[model samples]
Target: MKIRISWQGKEVEIESGSPGAVLVEAFGWKDPRPIAIRLGGELLDLHSPLNREGEVEPVFPEDPEALPVLRHTAAHVLAQAVKELFPEARLGIGPATEEGFYYDFEVPRPFTEEDLEAIEKKMKQIVKRCYPLRREELSKEEAERLFSERGETYKVELIREIPEDRVSVYRQGDFVDLCRGPHLPHTGMVKAFKLLSVAGAYWRGDERNPQLQRIYGTAFFDKEALKAYLERLEEAKRRDHRKLGRELELFSIEEEVGPGLILWHPKGAIVRKEIEDFWREEHLRRGYQLVYTPHIALRDLWKVSGHLDFYAENMFAPMEIDERAYQLKPMNCPFHILIYKSRKRSYREFPIRYCELGTVYRYERSGVLHGLLRVRGFTQDDAHIFCREDQLEEEIFRVLDLVVYFLSVFGFEEYQIYLSTRPEKYVGSEEIWEKAEGALAAALEKKGLSYEIDPGEGVFYGPKIDLKIRDVLGRFWQCSTIQVDFNIPERFDLSYIGPDNRPHRPIMIHRALLGSLERFFGVLIEHYAGAFPVWLAPVQAVVLTVADRHLPFAEEVQRELSRAGIRAELDARGERLGFKIREAQVKKIPYMVIIGDKEVEGRRLTVRTRKGENLELGLEEFCARVRREIAEKIVF
Candidate 1:
């Protein structure tokens, strides 16, 4: 078979009998260098035989899919280096991530920084060998026997789990791995790579399984590209929320309190209170009635909502209470449903909006718990709307409006949206599912928002729209979601009187604009690098004294600022004034008010902005300006 292909902007005819290497040479594709070939919507290494009779295009290093492919090959090289140095080690999975790749190995001891350096040196040596990555397929039994003979227990276990009769493997020199195809042609192509760090990981992410040492690394086609990524990694390390949280006295996770449970220090609590106050005000202004729910409920409630059937594994175990079973609440929707059904409703109450900052608990693995991003107990900015079908789109649009407003105020203007369709295990009927999906799509269209289709990613109950916001560092964080549920209303038989004087089921909408407050706060800390704006700053201003003579005036200034509702601190210690100012700067205070001899004599206030701008003002003027900034909720 023959097919037309494009290479270097030239159209040529090629036969399927030839391998990709022939095409690469025929087109002189070495300038940008085609590491892989794309044909029939599949990527193949340059040495692989091309069997597709279709238009083919060489995948250049600059293509979108090139980095991941390159990084996966780098992981293979890393594994090869490990084998060369430590022949007794057994390998685990090594997959490419968005930023890099990692490989796990079962070893007697954990790796050290020195080991990483040695592995890097060994990897460079193997790259010079230029061993071709040959792909092979064997029967399941044969694959298991091969790995078993090599003492690769992990590979044998994985091979047995494969339902396919045959399994694919890749080989480079003497190193072989159970993997799919689409690897680099050879090891010499491995360049511009770095071995990042090492950590312990369980087999298949299960804690009960044997733990393996995981090494993470990244690669780029060119040195300059790799340099830019390393710089970004450095910036990310500096902005890591965990480090900022402790240094700024914002929050912490204690050994006694348990992992994934954030204990907000005094300063952190102040910031949280400010965020919650704004959330409450906006929710109330949007016609949402605030409500509360208990932290624990009867076990029967979850069974009725289908959480037990589909989400039991993620839920905590139940406890005995008064000869009955009680479970911690993993969600707030069921409680809101019960609240709606507490009384009879009329058509006049067609649209019911209930919002809650309800704290819920779920069982999260200790290994996966991040600082404040992933926690077992956290408060959700959850709201549910019960309305007629006609009002569905409008309610969805309104929720989107609120979501955009909140994000914009928080200085997050870049975001990605996704429309998720029903899952295979969804509760609703096919027709209802389609209708719900269409309704969400229509709402997105009406809002003039573009979203990608995330197939089969919706909740087990319904379709949803998820908004992931991009931080200042260009990192994406999942923050908000809106879901259209038909199952909950049907399960609870929620009804309202219609114009025809008959009971009509109202459609339910579940929305969480901020997902979890804890996670959002963590994102905010990183986004602003722990220098919260004046409105959210725990100590918006601090009054500093230049000398002992200014102590009386400093007390007066601090009292004045505090009376005007400014979160201020007075640094009247005998320490040097420069030291006080430096400490305040480290604390990330937005403004520093100087009470010096000149200011005291003039009965005036001298303010130094966080950015180092100074201004002189009367007592009333300073208070007015501070209040205005707070009222405006200005984002720095």
Candidate 2:
């Protein structure tokens, strides 16, 4: 049969009986391997037979589809190695995640560092053995019996939970797993693999379920790619925000203070204040009206907004006040919606943009919390745009432009944008969903930007456009989102008078350029390795005196820099020049103005950059250079 395969924009036709068979043959060609196969509108398995003509796209290794396959196969290799070594370990779920793959196992003891090393060694051996992977279909009863005969109770339990009568199992050598898979053809296909770390995870991700030891691992298609990834991981570790936060005395999460709660020290607060100032200026420039909302609102407000019913799980528990219940705001959408409903609006005033650095709270799972990246209380750089249907595309384009501009300022040039369409359980009407999704797509296309369409990956309320910024280590973080919500206006009964003087529901566009201030700050720390740009740096410059005689000059220079709006301080402590320089470098200060008797007498200051470059300049000239760099927001 003839089949058409299209990817990105290219298309080709091949004759084959099955998708996998066709790919196996096509792999011999110089074409990129498909990560997924789309037969008609359905995502079909690579192993599924193609009996008729249809469109197919090959998802290559760089495609998102390949990540899941690589991660899933890595999980299988992990399981096989575990069974070979421990023999008594009970398997639970092994699935691929956005970052990597993880497998949960109930073992007699938690996996030690040495145990992980051994397991990794065995996995390498399995990869070297080049065992062929074969899939077999069996009735649910037979699958359960087969697993039961092998004393794999977890596999039997998993099979029992399956609603289908038939199940698929993949076997390689002596190990077999009950999985619906399109795994690699053989173990040797896993070229670059590494076991990340071991952690405790609940079976099926349910807290009430028994906790199992989870082994996390990541794999790549080639050895060189793997080495690069490993190096990136090392760099990421060195740039970890948590480590930097502690070292720089920026923030703290105390055991007594509570988990998922951050205590911003003076240094951290300075950074935060600078960020807020920049945000306010940018929003004002972009025609956004800044608004402040309360941290807590009546419980009924959320109920009216539908968040209490639909988003209750993520919300913190309600508290009683004067025999009435109140809830901590989990999101700023409801508050912003209330602001729009406060007064009647005309069509001329339809596109009302309200922006806020709103602090919200959510009850995140304990095990999932990671420093500032995942927290309970965080501030969202949120904005809502209320506009007519005709203005939707223009507004989306504006938002997209703003996101690109803001991210570029932070040195985030590479981004992975995803436009998500309506899900099966979405609230909006089909026509509305279509119109909103089309507007987002049109905006992306108009800007000549490429984005992936995530069908059925949208929010329950409406479709959304998500932007993931690629960090220095090449990892993507979901930092920006622009969602079109038709349900909120309807549920809240929001309306604005149209050109015809008829009341019409305003199209609400919810957006967060930097999803959360706390999370974004963490990403920023890692992205720049704690050495912020002069414009955003908490302490942009430090004046270090070489000796007691230079202390007066250092203080004078510090005052001069401070007057020029640079965050400069004098290091007048009883320490040697080398110690002071070392201290400034450790703090990642962008610039250090070193003053000694020789330089002070000559009316010059020795300049040292964070990257270890040194220069000597007149005091007045140095100030001019610093001012220009700060004004320009130079990144180094």
Candidate 3:
């Protein structure tokens, strides 16, 4: 049969055979970079026959889609190498991840560092052999028989669960794996690869299943790219929030306190207070009514909010309070909704905005908890806007404006925004969904901001807009979310008197500018490497005396800065000036005010910034400069 395919902006017709044959004819069999083909928007194996005519695009190493394909193939190769090294090893599923690939194996024992080294050597040998990968389709009975004969119980179990009678398997050398693959032509194509680490994982991610040894690895097409990635990984390790948190004495997660619960130290508490103070003032200035809510409420509240039905997994067990069940608040939305229902409102009071730095508790798996980023208890900078239908779009516009302003204030200027649409299970009607989605889209367009549509990824109650802020290391953290909910107001029977004096449903918009203060602080720690700006720093400046005689002057300097409202500390620990300055730098204090004999005699302060820029100025002048920096929230 003949097929029309698009290649390099040109369409051509050719007599089709195998996809590999067609592609080789178009872009040469010797072209090493084109490893796969995209047809009908699905990545396909080159060896598969072109049974139908369709538009096709070549998958190159540099393309975004190529990384997963490359990593998937690398995973297969890893499995192959493991089987070769240990003939009795049984394979579980192997999949590609955003950063790399990992494969789980049911081995006799957990893999060790030496085992990883040996596996790496075997993988290199496999790559050098240049074994061509081949695909084979089989009936379910045949696949079952093949895996059963090889004693591959996991493979047999997988094949038995296939709904369809047909299954596909790929083979390279003497190794075979059940997969739907578009792997590279030969093993040698994976030029640069590294086995990252080994960890234990349960099959299918279930604790009830047999545990398997999971080996993590990454592959790049070129050596330089691999080197750069490794360097980035090292830098990320150095900037890890948990490490910085301990070193800076910012926060802690204690076993005695319980996992996933953060204990904010004095320094960390100061930073959090600053963030909350800023949040409260800005919200008040922007016409938001600051309100407070209880940490736990009657279970009936959550049931009405649909948390019991839809989000029970993330919710903590209910408490029997006075013989009535009460649940720890997993969300602040229901509480905010109750506040709106407490008052009778008119259209003139439309767009009634209520905000809270509300602390919430959710049950998170211990294994998933990571420092403050993933925690059971966190305070959300949450707000809800109850408005008329006509005010929906304007409210959303305002929310987006606030999101940008909030993120930018923390030195996060780069962001990716997504408009998430209705999911399969939703509470609202099609008309409401359409209107809410349209309103969100209009707000984005009105602001001249571009966003991608995340199809069917919205919360069950409504469509939403999610904002992910990219940090200094180019890592994206999901921080802001603006959801348009028509269901909750209807569920709560919320109403406002219109101009016609009729009771109408007020649209509820749930938004969080900084998702959770705990997670946001974690991101900030890593983004700035714990060297917060002058405004956000726990200790903005340190006063260090050069000698015992200089203590009075240093204390005086500290008093002046404290009087000027700077978070300054005086280091009169009888330590050497150089040692004290080094300690201040280690704590990431933004400025160090030096008090020595010369500076005291001159009535001047010798200031050294964290970046090592030195300046000589009067104590008052230095204090004024710092005040301006803090007032302006200068990043440096």
**Top candidate (lDDT):** 1
What tens-digit string does per-residue lDDT give for candidate 3 at 1-636? 787777666676776655554676675545554788888788886766576667777778888888888889899999999999998999999999988999999999889999999999999999999988888889999999988988899999999999998998999999999998878878998779999999888888676789899999999988898999999889989999999999999999999999999999999999998899999999999999999999999999988988888899899999997999999999999989888888799999877999999999998766568899999999999999999888899999999998898888899999899999999989878998999999999999998889999999999889999999999878899999999887788788999999999998888999999999999999999999999998899999998887889888888888989999999998888877789888999999999988888988998999999999999999889989999998887885
Candidate 1 per-residue lDDT over residues 510-572, each given as its tens digit: 999989999999999999989998889999999999889999988988998999999989888
The regions of model 3 sitting more than 4 angstroms off are 1-17, 26-33
Q: TM-score of predicted model 3?
A: 0.96
Question: Over 4 Å off in model 2, which ranges?
Answer: 1-71
C-alpha local distance difference test of each model: 0.90, 0.86, 0.89
User: How do all models score by TM-score?
Assistant: 0.96, 0.91, 0.96
Clashes of each: 0, 3, 0
